[model samples]
Target: MRLAIIGGLAAGPAAAAEAKRRAPDAEVVLFEQGPHISVGTCEIPYLLGGHLEPETTLQVLTPEAMERTRGVTVHVRHRVTALDPRRSRLTVEALDYGSTREEAFDRFILATGARARRLGVEGEDAAGVFTVRDLVDTHAIQRWLDTQPVRHVVIVGGGYIGLEMAEAMRSRGLRASILDPNGRVLGSTVACEASDLMDRAVAEAGVPVRAERATEILAEDDGRVRAVRTDRGELIGCQMVIVSVGVEPRTELAAAAGLRLGDMGGVAVDDQMHTSARSVWACGDVVQIPRAPDGRRVLWPLATMARRTARVAARNAAGSASTRSADRFRPFAGAVGVRAFGVEVGSVGLSLSRALDAGFDAVATDVRHVSRTRAFPEAAPIDVRLVSERGSGRILGGQLVGREGAALRANVLVPLVIGGGTVRDLAEDFDLIYNPPLGPAVDPLKVAASQAMRDAG
Candidate 1:
């Protein structure tokens, strides 16, 4: 089998490695347009904060290591310009030398990933404005920091990237402010109470946040960002601006090849990660897969989801008989975590608003507990919230907020929600580990589950 994978950042490399492992004799080739492959994009914020070294972030998987150890052909600085699904061929270009060639493959995986969404405001082309997407963007920001006197930074979004960058700027002794179009921070993913907590945390870290949209980016005569004008006619001055509005799937290549797209604006793929075109599969941020809670197709764009879908796509491409079975490939339940302003937050499955929107009578309960026993002097407060179906008590989702152990606690609910466990089952049957230094005997998860059960009743 000739397996060709496009876009080697996260999923493409995984697909190539997995395909080679499954079928040793198969020819697996991976192509990445950028100079680097398998970058840890999630750690980019830490690079700005000086917590993580730049060299460490670029060491995910070198092309030479991928080829030598994994037995996969790794081609960096090579872009796949066109894909002809009917002919099972790809037109590639060598970026450095301006050379083009055609490669035929028996199977192909598209892991094209996503690009950062632009603000599209006036003066967006100004010099001091940047979008955090890849290593190049990171280098650009670092160069600006070194060359310019950037004392204050204005972030134009309230999502994870915006929040993380705010924290990073604070660590660098710069004034960081976030301007969000949404009324609340993390409003789309977290509940109002949790969002309120995060707002307070950011405020405590000396980062000013405003719930207003940026109307335009005003630039000086030198074409550098000077100030940002808001909808309320306020101009906030800043030396630099970071836009983290979100990301959109890079699926122009797939669309040009006549591949079907989902309602979420991603390449449509089935549970087995097979695209609409035969002999081709799509994974990573470029594809929309089923959300396990409601079985609705949604764009997760998470690293964990990317790797899982890539493995499934690779096994299928390798013609593994066991992988062809329906039961082996499970749908993805969205799980995500973020740390900002010394607070760790995590969420799994759906928020209460999302559950209600999915046509379920959902009720939620929030419980506050000490992470450790009261006798422990280092005990910190942990807040947990659980949402469940009103009548059936079926667990739907959960959120956790704390200085520590918040992400791990939220992760425990993922399996329960995926396995269709009820709130009562978690309250009565779940045996969570207990240690005085780590957590109390009565786990916070159980407390949230028990409260959710009562709220539902």
Candidate 2:
């Protein structure tokens, strides 16, 4: 059996290794358009902030190492220009030599990941504008900082990356400001109270956020960025601009090959991670996952979903012939959108707005509780908002924001929400321990869940 994989980032490489494990004798190959593969994309910000050295662990595995250890062929700087699902073949371009070649496969997997979104405004191609999504992007931002006198940086989005880059720039003694048209960070995915907590968090970090649209990028005579022009006809001065708005799935190859795509703009995959096309599947940020509580397909560009879906796609493709597990139809497990920040914030399943959009009569119950008891010195507060369905009393989702346990609380919410647990289930059935200077007598998660049960009643 011949297996061909497009993309060499987190998902693609993982699928290749998993395939090799499942079918040892099968010929497995992975292609990455960039010079590097198996990158630790989440570490890019620390590299920018000088917290990490690029020469260190930023790149997880090299092409040579992957080929040597995983028993799979790895190709870097190879671009898949076209894919023909009917023939089970693809056209690959050697970027270095500018030569094209055809490869045939019995099974194929696409982990094309995502691309940085552009503002579509003029002067975007100037010298000092950047998007720090990959190793190459981090290196480019480093090069800009080294070559140019960048004392002031304007981040164009207030999402996770934008907020991280803001702290990263400030840590480097650069004045960083956020320009978000949505007037808030994290968008509408977070509950209203959580958004308020995020606002306070960024302000305390000394990052000024401007709630306005950036209409254009102004550059100097030498084609270097100078300022950003807003829709209100105001110019926000800056020497550099980071475009961290967000990312969309890179599904051009799949779409051109007549593969189905979900309304969420990701390649539509079934429970087995199989695309509509025969003998082909897609994972990573390119594919959609079934959101819990309502099974609505959502394109969440999260590493956890990418890896889980990759395993399903790989095991199904490589071990399809085996009747070892009759119902080997594996779907992605539960997933929640989580971001690490000074004031960490995360949401699982659905927000109140998303519940309403999904045609559920839902209400969000907010609770503020202490991280520790009063006896503990300077116990911090945790903000949790639980979203519950009205009549059914099902636990739809939750948003948590705090400096201490926001991310951990989010992890606790995932299993319960995915298990179809109800408000009462979260409130009483869940085991939450308590200790002074560790956690309060009644955990914030339970407090919020109990509040949600009351609101439902």
Candidate 3:
């Protein structure tokens, strides 16, 4: 059996390795358009900040190593232009060869992730504006930083990538300014409260944020970006600009092949990662997945979901009886954990506003406490807002903001909600580990849960 997988970053490589494990005799091959395969996209920010070195950014597993160790072939810089499902073949263009080739496969997996979004503005194609999605983009920006006297940077977007790049550019001694059309910093991803927290952090760090604004990149004499003009009648002076508005799944190949696309603008797949087409599967950021709290298909671009879905695709492709585990098929565990400015802020599940929108009577309780023991040294005030169903006391969602050990508690709320545990469950039966050097004797989660249950009654 011959199996072919496209886009050998996280999902493609995972499916290949799992297929190799399931069917040792099967011939499996994966293709990646980039120079390196199986690189961690989430570590890009740390790499830019010098927290992680670029030399160690790409996880280099040579094709020879994969072939010898796992019986898989990894072809780098091989771009699949088209897929013929009827013939079970892919039209691949190898950039190094300057030629196209057709490869046959008995089974195929489409994990061709997403591309960075671009602005349609007149001068957006100028030399200094770039996106920071892939390693190549990161390298390009880093190389430019090394050569240019970049004193100011204009980031057009307030999403995760844009905010991280702002911090990274600031660390590089550049005056970083963000221009977001949305009223809040994180916009749709985070609630207004969390957005305000980020705004405060950015302000304290001396980073400039122009909210409710759009940009028009203006070019200088050499067709290079000189400044960014906003729709709100303001011009931000900067030579370098980074735009990370958002991403759309690269599903053109799959859509052309008669596969289903989801409302979330990604490929549609079943719980087992099988697409509508026979013997074809999809995963990663390309697939629209079930959202938590409700079962709506949402495209959550976290790495964890991609890996789990890849295992399902690999199992089916290898003719194994294995199915996607229940844990993998569920909605996003609903956690966006972030820490900045000597403070931690996190949100999980649905916010009170979201729960109300979803036709649930949501009640929220705001609790404040010292992160450490009251008398302990370096204690910081912690604030938690616990949201629950008004009648049932079921823990629906939560938000945590404080200094020290606070962001992690938001992670704890996700599993509780995912497992269908209620506020009563947390209030009465939650077991917490405690250490004077780490956690308080009464865990903040339990404290919040108790308050939630009391309010529910």
| lDDT score at residue 116, model 3, on the 0-100 scale | 83
Ranking by TM-score: 1, 2, 3
- Candidate 3 ranges with C-alpha deviation above 4 Å: 60-64, 191-196, 321-328
Q: Which candidate's TM-score is highest?
A: 1
Best-matching candidate per lDDT: 1
Model 3: lDDT to the true structure: 0.79
lDDT comparing candidate 1 with the true structure: 0.86
For all predicted structures, in order, the TM-scores are 0.96, 0.95, 0.93
Model 1 error, position 131 (Å): 1.3
Give the worst 10-residue stretch by lDDT in candidate 2.
324-333
Per-candidate Cα lDDT values, in order, are 0.86, 0.83, 0.79
Compose the digit string of candidate 2's lDDT tens values, residues 1-457: 9999899778998899998998899999999999987888887877788777656677788999999999999999999999998998999999999999999999899999999889999999998999978988888898989898898999999877787788789879889888988777777434434447778877877788888888999999999999999988989999999998789999999999999999988999888788999889889999987877777777878777787778878888888656324423333324444443367777777878878999989888888888778688768888888888886678888888877777677778777677777889888888887888788888999998888887987
What is the lDDT for 214 in model 2? 85
